[model samples]
Target: MDKSAMSDPQQPATVAILAYPEATASVVYGMYDLFMATGRDWGIVTSGEAGPSLLRPLVVAARAGPLLATNEVRIEAQASLQECSSADFVCVPDLNIPPGESLEGRFAEEVEWLRRCYAAGATLASACSGTLLLAEAGLLDGQEATVHWAYCDELRRRYPKVMVRAQRALVVSGEGQRLVMAGGGTSWLDLALFLIARSVGVDAAMQVARINLIDWHAIGQQPFARLARTRQVEDAIIAGCQTWIAEHYCEHSPVAAMVRLSGLAERSFKRRFQLATGMSPLDYVHRVRLEEAKQMLESGDDPIEAIANAVGYEDAGFFSRLFRRSVNLTPAQYRRRFGSMRRALNAGV
Candidate 1:
């Protein structure tokens, strides 16, 4: 339970990005840009709701002194590290705190401030190596957390009392209290946007997404699929081909054309394609067509032949057979089942 991850309910969700005497500029700028880009008070000004909040953010340095910046960017700090009041969320952001120098002496000051803030009802959060700050603070002594996978082993080794889990994007603990953490450098944006969404609303979160050009689905979502690491290059090729196929399904692009895009020789491409996706290129194309046919069947009233041809299938029976084989149901049956599910989900909501 990294103390930084635990958010306080009473705080207007102020994130005071901690500026260590030797913190990196990238982390500092990243935190600053991410927050300002994503956060804005709508000033609904309703009598019932709290009037437009003045709770913005401040980047402060430890020890109430000037701090060295990374990459020669000397940003001024307006608040002292000891100025821990007026914040519901305090972020160490990202910095490398040496293991031997942490959890004691000078590091004690930051930890004490963190504990005080948490006790005062502020959520404390860290990003990447910033988790080390919390571990040093002893808040993670018996709690599960996630750091960048490269640092997970070292964090666990240095603080044996902290239970480290590496499989997820973000780790959360503390019910009334909160301890949430993330792996990967860019995941900091995810954590920040998530905090914004929780404190504000989805509109603010989406603004963050547009600012960072981030994928909307992954923000605030946990247990991110590790599949990206396993087959990133291959997946990119496949996704490119998939997009091409979807756009050109009606054009009836040849399998050889798709195989060429994979950059592998025909025979080798077929083998790898089947190994990667469990289906040959043409079979996958056919599957896509059949899937589209199923979709058409639900919202559309076109004839089966027209739908089949629209998805690159000319023979009606062949399309039906392929659709049934891949989807475990006939096109009509799939339309019924999935359409029912979609309608039910929408209606229930």
Candidate 2:
């Protein structure tokens, strides 16, 4: 387990992919296929001969046997925690558990195995909710990490010491940059490529990507995130205001109109709204407007200025700046990215 030996190109790095009942089958198998392809598949496709395998990927579970994963997919584990004592890298695939669900007694053995791997100089990596396991293991304390966007808030709430970057598609942190994570969805492809590049070589990783037609998620997760909806609150007045604002967000002085509709003094209305929704009335209005703008940009080919006006912003420059600040992408950029997706789907239909 010499760290220095890991740099040798001739040495195939051992990758232990953790599998459990909560694991997603696609992520587990996808990562396994990609890692197995790293140094060997490219040459086979090009010259009809396999090249040297650079990584050894093993599906490791608590018990070495067939297990049912999320969605009832059967996964055959190559080794158990007790059998796989150490590895050069440990990968935790996306878990199907809800973000807010308690992990109080879950993955106890897997977490302990991860801690042992880290202590043995193995790099730890996760995809999506799998970052929760790393956090639960106390491996990500005070370290910056990224998870599936929906889980980012929950991760922050559960582990205040861990810095969560919801916008990043991939993040590398921890001592010697040993911890790596990929954001939600299929960004696990990026995680696999990154580890291959780091362990084998960049050329090997690029070849694997080309062979698999895998593209890196360079745009990050901001554009894909659905704006958090304002949940209905116990306060009837604020709840009524929320329903009203959803329809009339494009109207000028909407917050003022809401205040009047609330039938309370403006000062009292604002205070009650904040207490109910956790944001000021004006901020809530902006969220509604931006969410509408996002939908229009994704579904239509309207000009940016026109979309801005439709969303209640007359000054296109101001709208663009605000959109960039809030969504991390300008209206035009968001359209270009998501609009094409819409069209592609429509064309197929």
Candidate 3:
């Protein structure tokens, strides 16, 4: 089928991005911008002085008033938490995980909310550590969930029942649009584009990717995707090595160490690791640290120095600068924007 044959894919998707004080503006704004462009490109809605208004991307709050992002970006929510009930697609983007009760905090409310939303046929999505909230809500209790890699341990420990696949680009489960996970914040662009493709058609989705300068492709199977090699000797070794690293990322090791632990030769371990996991062992570790820093910035108030050290960085200043360059926000600023939630409630006096 040609791209010209289908249009109006946007009709079925109603994306309601939840604005938790810590939710990144990049994720929110990026999704809205790309989705709109996609709608226009696919002829789901033509662009002109008089264009169709088929796709509506909105930022909604769990309560009221303006919300802040990690970079101090502010945006107003058009609907309240009550509004998720009406949305066809519901998102709980990067909600700040308060240290102790990030998941358990307001767990009952969100769980009930998800139960209702899912029952009503709304698809769900989360970026960064937002999956913790979904896990709290029970949507991911027994399903596969992918989040920023740093929190993989916590997710695995907290919800032992759920199969937490850490260090992945994303995870898609539940038929049609039941559940979706986008790992890195930047990956949100990819997820949104895929959503657009479904709603408005591929041509429009591709156009948006072109406009956003995003890379959209089915490159060799996902680097993080699980290989179907079965439980072979090398595969077992790789799994043990992964378990070892998760426990001790701060300690440095050469390929020989991983090889010895896996009981495989360095050459064989390197080859199978690449095939099973799609990345060299060290590349995977760096990916984990980066993901951890992202989650810390969005949910906690620890200084960059503390966060850096806690996440395996000994040089606080270097980590601070490197993190900002990578995430597009200083660690401190990212925390202020995405973690702290300020509510203007009960002031009708």
Candidate 4:
């Protein structure tokens, strides 16, 4: 075998951005541009002579043709699956879709191609709804995956075999580091930087990030996620208890109140709550209280202790710890990151 053909350290790595109809334009193009620039520019910076390229990126579709973006923008597929045959990395960009929309069998061939690529030793990745493709392909079975918080429930419902850690910004799983999933919004940017760092070098990824002015979001989705008042449980009684908790989470002894309202025996109510919400009644109550605390912390200048007290936490120290555990940020940190004291106070009722 030719030395250059074999995983040569000096040779460039090939990356394929899998484009499809209605895919998010930014993710597809951004992946190509970022990967290309990182490798090309890294060469420019290191040797000053544009040395051996570190990465080669191309857009691939089900076939060699033009694919449509969400806004009907046309993006040409530079290569087809057969044309590329394989890649060092494969990125499946988000397919922009509304809530409750089905991605069922939308890209069945592409999904199969992804499975093939993984089996052939290519690392597979996705952003936002693109994780749906991975899930449908069975690559995510019994693996930890993350997706847009809005679609987490649906993904879990549809693919019961996969564990959905919807609160994470990115999840890397599968055997031998073969799978990566990025959550919603501009997370494709994060994925791009991550891929560049992983395959190229961190210094090269940093160079590209500087050129793109990308402020990497190091945080997870917990801070931005609004926990569902009613989780996707089929039990109507449990759903009603969830609603009641949402309404009266700040009241003293809310869990006891919920149990009384549930009308089930104490043991039965506890069991059902856990089965439905994946949280004990007390944990559920604390979760709701902390969510309210977050709102107050973000929109008001009240002291942390005051906020805690208002949210039914008499022990401010304990509340701060709980907040940190749940939101992955202390109350103070969350306020600084997302609070708008002036905007909230100034907005007229």
Every candidate's lDDT: 0.66, 0.89, 0.65, 0.83
Best by lDDT: 2
Clashes of 2: 0
Q: What is the lDDT of residue 138 in candidate 4?
A: 94
Lowest summed lDDT window (length 10), candidate 1: 221-230
Ranking by lDDT: 2, 4, 1, 3
Give the TM-scores of the predictions, in the order they appear.
0.53, 0.91, 0.57, 0.83
lDDT of 2 by residue, 266-306 (tens): 99999999877657999888878988999999888889999
Model 3 off-target regions past 4 Å? 1-12, 41-53, 96-101, 175-177, 217-349
- The runs of at least 3 residues in candidate 1 whose Cα sits more than 4 Å from the true structure, single-residue gaps closed, are 1-12, 39-55, 97-103, 175-177, 216-349
The sequence of per-residue lDDT tens digits that candidate 1 reaches over residues 112-222 is: 787777677777778777888788777888888878755665687788998887645677765344666766677877777777776677787775677467753232222
Model 3 agreement with the true structure over 1-349: per-residue lDDT tens digits:
1222123454535677777666777777767776555445434334443335346676777765687776789877777667545566666676555423454565565667777777766778787778787777767867888876556656776778778765456687765657888765467766786666655678767767765679742321123222212223446778787777666666655355677888877788888887766578666666567667766666556777777887777898887777655555567765664455321222333
Question: Lowest summed-lDDT stretch of 10 residues in model 3?
Answer: 220-229
Specify the poorest-scoring 10-residue window by lDDT in model 4.
1-10
Which residue pairs clash in candidate 4?
none
Indicate the residue-level lDDT of 136 in model 4.
89
Which prediction has the highest TM-score against the true structure?
Answer: 2
> Model 4 over residues 1-349: C-alpha lDDT tens digits?
1223327666678788998876877778878888778756656766785644568888998888887778888889998887777778889998677646776777777988898889878889899888888998999999999998777877888899999997789999999988999996788888988998999789888988886789887888788777654554588888888888778877898878878887999899999988887679998888788878888987789999999998888999999999998888999999988886446666755
Listed per candidate, the RMSD to the true structure in angstroms reads 12.8, 2.7, 14.4, 4.0
Cα distance off (Å), candidate 4, residue 242: 3.2
Model 2 Cα shift for residue 124 (angstroms): 0.9
